[model samples]
Target: MFSADTEQWARDTFHHSELGDRRRSKRLVQLASSLANHLGQSLVQSLKSPADIEAAYRFTRNQAIDPQAIAEAGFAATVENTKHYECLLALEDTTSLEFSHSTVRGDMGHTTSNNYSRGMFAHSVLLFAPHEQHVVGLIEQERWTRNIKDYGKSQNHAKRPYLEKESYKCERASRAMETRLGEGMSKIISVCDREADLIEYLAYKTSNQQRFVVRSMQSRCILESEDKLYQYSASLTDAGMRTVQVRQKGGRKARRAVCEVRYAPITVKVPSNKKGEPVELYYVGCQEREQEKGLNWHILTSEPVRSKEEAERILDYYEKRWLIEEFHKAWKSGGTQVENLRMQSKENLERMVVILAFIAVRLHQLRYLGLNKEEAEKQSCEMILSPQSWKILWSKQEKRKPPKKAPSLYWAYINLGKLAGWYDSKRNGRVGWERLWEGWFILQTILEGYLLAKSLDL
Candidate 1:
């Protein structure tokens, strides 16, 4: 069962969204809490009763529930929260939400493999607290289903307007942020991968006085000559060396890669088709000095890098971009299982996507909160876990005696991880998101039984 406090928080977070009738917005909060509590469960299981399921369908089908309005409400809350922090990194990226099986009443986009799939491409700006290294949540998101007829059109050597191209998704995402938060804030830096290295986007950001760090994708002419980007960057001496952690992919273990960092200012010639003048930008490059094939990142930023520390700082912001991808993982399969939603219309699915996306960020936050032992010890477990949850975990995991006060949240998470099959050996390391959530769901189930028993005694 969902706790009253959790339900109230959901309502408060979504209160700004005007979904036709006020009652509809309230229903949305109730439905969202249910979805979050029963992560990976189908809508029927999450809603529990037949009456609630029917109501959910009605809410979903309502044309009044605009995805953009609801998204803006969430974004407003994020902006308000960011007012307290001096610096926030707005990590932007795009991900495809596949609903290939659903015969929704609208056209869908092509998946990464160019397969015919029914889905929406979401270009989003995920906010992060730079110093704390915690994901603050998404502040902006733009969704679109591709018009398949336009697919091979860009391949032809044509001088199409930037708005006519599909790559405009990055520009739209950045513009949405600027529209909401304005320019010259100095507190926020937009971060993106190589896909966002367009001169037009960089020029727009600069014109609007917005800070950004985008990994370079194009090797266009630079410095009023034919100097290639790679050759020009290679000529510059190394600024410094740093060890960075790289995530594992395709059966490889996570490891650190040592790389030398270099930075230089370059002027990229504007594409003749576009109206913008030459865009002068700084390039920060990192090359791995290790095995045959490893990590190499060439970044372009609006922020000037005068020293190694400043360049590393920009790279650090880019590192936070991975958090947004992890947010997608948590949204898709890891936690909320958004793709399982069976709504039959594009409008309905988009509404649910907005709600689930925020919930996924919260779930990711929960998994990260209790990981740090030192910080967790200084805080009360009740801040995250309920009293019953910590007590039950302490009793079951410790086996002999329960502590007078609840165990620290970190210890509780450790026990929760153990419940999910993690061994106590040091080599086993800390709990991961997959196992931690597995234990969390199991605990919620056991807590339902414990509550039932208490009610019987009463």
Candidate 2:
């Protein structure tokens, strides 16, 4: 819990956001806190009472709770937090908000998969403090419903400027991060997955002196090598080895993977139309030497990768990029279920979705704090939660009176994991964002009740 009520925390978090009227801002904060409390419930189910439902609708209809304003507030907080870190890692990615089979489908755009699927594409950058692996905040978010008519133009993308292409989302996100982060930071490395390997984006990053580690999806041409990018990387000597913890997915068992590390400096050839000189960068490859389907990572970075330690650092940052993907899961199915909303107004839905994004980030950061027991034990739950909230959570989790001193944030999450059905003896390791926030939703209700009782002095 923070120093104030959770609703007050919401207001303070969005303090730089302009929502037209002070009353409107207050209502937005209240609504956000209420929604986070009832994360599993629908709008009507969460509101419950007629008066509460009416208030929620009134706030939604106010026309002042702009989605851009909500995102701007998050961006401001991200910038503020960056001041504390000399080096930060920002993970950039995109996910679709599918609202298929809905009556308001026409308002939403077509997803990449099928014409029938309708939704908006959410492209965002999630900032992180790499030292502690803590999610610092959300840097910026851009949402756009694709125009079906222009979808064909994507086929002829080579003729068009990079800005006109759909792939520009990567560049847009990176630029926004640089502009927002400003100057004075020792390092700000933007990490992205395969889809972000664009010549233009790489050039922009190099010109601006911004650091990045983008997973290479293209078998591009490397300077002084007849072989393609992937082939050339394969020819490099194995620099060293690192044991990476690979999370289970797609029927794979969770295990510590021994990855063969390789690194080399490469001059990436630029596309003719872009009119830029060849860009000099490093290529780092990480792969398990002998699995049927080996865990492989081919990364392109602006930073030097001369040593084994540096190559590991590059791979480490790319691994952190998976956190944002987990973030998208937490944003959607895990916590908000943003696609479940039946709101007819796309504008209002966007605004509400942005609010849920903030909540998702908070849940993510808290859950990650529990990863390192020594580090987590040093963190006070009270600093992160309100005293009333923690007291109620402790009471329910311990099945006894509240403790005089606040429990470590790690213990709070451990109790939360139990509440959410996570077994301590499970070999899969720590509980994920899903179970963490699921338990948090139940805890929020207890917090609400405690706040109400204190107000009434009953």
Candidate 3:
């Protein structure tokens, strides 16, 4: 989605990467191009030549190559893209990457209390253009392996310094974005889940004048009032009713939930244990009026929520928070399958994961392109697939000569699902990421063959 060809896009994305040596930066671009072209595949399968694969290993194993430098180039590219938009939603969340292989287990930390389960945690901030309803790119990401000894220290969280806590990742990312975006920081509205409701994090955002909509996890005391934050919110008059699409989680079926919206301005007092001043913020509450156990959202935001429309807008921004979760799935299990890596060293693993993280974002962008049927139909498939790629795909799917003009993105998207053995029927709804990437894999294979044939003039 960034460019017409994956190789050129990789160059544009990583050419400026400060990887110590110029050759290393070039190798990074080449490696990223190869990985991007054959996404969701293992290293051996993705790299075309044995020499290229060996070079990739050497690049990652190089002690001087910093993983953060590789990731920073991508973040730089994303920041440049963000400049074009007037406003964007910065969706932030954390996910774990677990490696169960015996070879890599020793280098990793425990993902859970089970010492055998080894992995690292990745906290990412994915930028989205709310107006366009599409992903921009990953602005900030932090990957760290947990100390195995600290696996059972949840009870001692409060005693630990704020910077040492895992929750600090969110605030750290915000600071990074602020540094990177500079003047553009005002254009961003950070949308986060309940985990970001920490008093320190909220206070930091408020002090920095960073606009945000965070789901409330705890009801802190209200300044100059007897009622707690949630209790005060409940007492406000119902502003209006909003119909929201509740996504399916586990056994719960996806359905529409009509929620009663209530909002008010409140000043939250810092707990006696904390050292921050009282922060004034708006609280937006949504209680489902239909189902007994329907969606209930307690939204706390720095944005103004004076009217019903403003309150609903805050909820909309909060709802976009799901995109980050989907992004994590795409990075870990759905598409890239980063956990499948068998790198022997944590350094090598970190380098590889940093590269694959960008590929996962590209995969997510491709799938997101087709989500809005109307917009997909109007847009050309060239927005994603290259001319050679789409032409071959069209010929294969239509069983005829390729069209002179590129087809609609929706047509390409649907047919890609068909290529991956998806049956279009009333029973089957929209095509998922698995099928979409499967289709992309098949198409890439065909495109390679076509290019080879044209090279030989056969």
Candidate 4:
């Protein structure tokens, strides 16, 4: 109806449009509200001027969102989003974006931000829901006085390094999910790669403390059985079944029974390479057993893994992490250059990460809506949106190309939008309806005459 009222929809989506300098300017909010009203889905002119965006921030934050509403919406959305992806929830910790506004190193060191010409840093977290093939949470975080370190290298078998900033961000996302957990929601199994071996993660899981499916690093995880944490263990076997998980890139993921070991409980100590030698620490309820040749199934849990099938299931869940890796590819590209954003000041960079995260979440909603067979039939609590609402929320699609780290789901919405009202061809070069009709007829005539004139080009 009337092109789906895009301008109003965009305005409403962003709680407020508080572009800083434009507090008094009337067009700031209008322009911010007009993003969805722009040319195409996978395209947009990022509001560069701080004055324009500060107003947008205030407009959203100051709009009087009830804490209760956010909490309720959070729970509802979790339930709705997870309804379909019941088996696995992929945990992702990657540098979705990084940029250093300054070449000089300070606290966070050089960053991988888009606007590196400015002193800024960009990093993000994305929760990939594999069953639905859409991002569950696309969160962004920024930092100033950056000391971002690359702790990917390990000196000993026990060290693990984690960014303090990322810890907080992951927790925030986890808390947001926790507040909504078990409120008629499907069970979720989170899978992460090596970097997530941090104590904060252990703490994060213990805090809300739901059962999760996680992977172990080659050197970082110290398996503990009877007070002694063992390092360099391969595969797990118990509970009347034999299974194997190989991480060193086996040619194929042959899931048949490979080998087995009499698994025992142990605390997997994560080694930290900073300030000293490898330190050994252990969390309770992790076990080790046997499986295939290279597959090390070190089961870390609050409770003993009950069966081999359960153990296989955990590794199976961890495999889902690859999906999040794929998502990072789309999100960091094209129109959504959340990673490419170069910030002059660190504060602005941080804000950009937060905003990008917010953007990712909305994009995820649209993608999920487009994929669901029963999108029209299903509804998520205020947190999760229905396909009907997706039509309104799908405002962020790109027309020409997918952005790096951009989700294909955005295209789904854009295609749907085209059906609704958005057109790809330029609505230009024609003065009016008569001109448009005449041009169309002229094109037809030219095609018809092309048999001779077009071929000869005389």
Span of 10 residues, lowest total lDDT, candidate 4: 428-437
Candidate 3 residue-wise lDDT, 265-296, digit = tens: 88888889889898899999999966787788
lDDT of 2 by residue, 130-198 (tens): 885668888888998988776655667778877887788887877777677667333688898888898
Candidate 2, position 65, lDDT: 68
Ranking by lDDT: 3, 2, 1, 4
Error of 4 at 138 (Å): 4.1
RMSD of each: 2.9, 2.7, 1.5, 13.1
User: Which structure among the candidates has the greatest TM-score?
Assistant: 3
Tell me the spans in candidate 2 whose CA falls farther than 4 Å from its real position: 1-5, 45-52, 150-154, 184-186, 272-274, 450-458
Displacement of the residue 403 alpha carbon in candidate 3, Å: 2.4
Scored by lDDT, model 4 comes in at 0.40
lDDT of each residue in 210-263, candidate 4, tens digit only: 545544444454444333333334343334434434332238653444544334
Model 1, TM vs. native: 0.91
Model 3, which residues run further than 4 Å from truth? Answer: 425-429
Least lDDT summed over 10 consecutive residues: which range in candidate 3? Answer: 424-433
Kindly list the per-residue Cα lDDT of model 1 for residues 1-458, writing each as its tens digit.
11224576576667787767888878888887787677677778877689999998888888877888788778877776777677888887888888855576255666555656668788878888888756677788888887766665546625677777667878787777767776425788888988888777888888877888899887777864566888778788899898888886569888899999998888888877677788888888988967768888889898888888889988888887778887787888777878777777788888888888888877777666665577767766676678877777777777766667766767866777887787757563467666776777777777778998999995
- Candidate 4 local lDDT, residue 279: 28
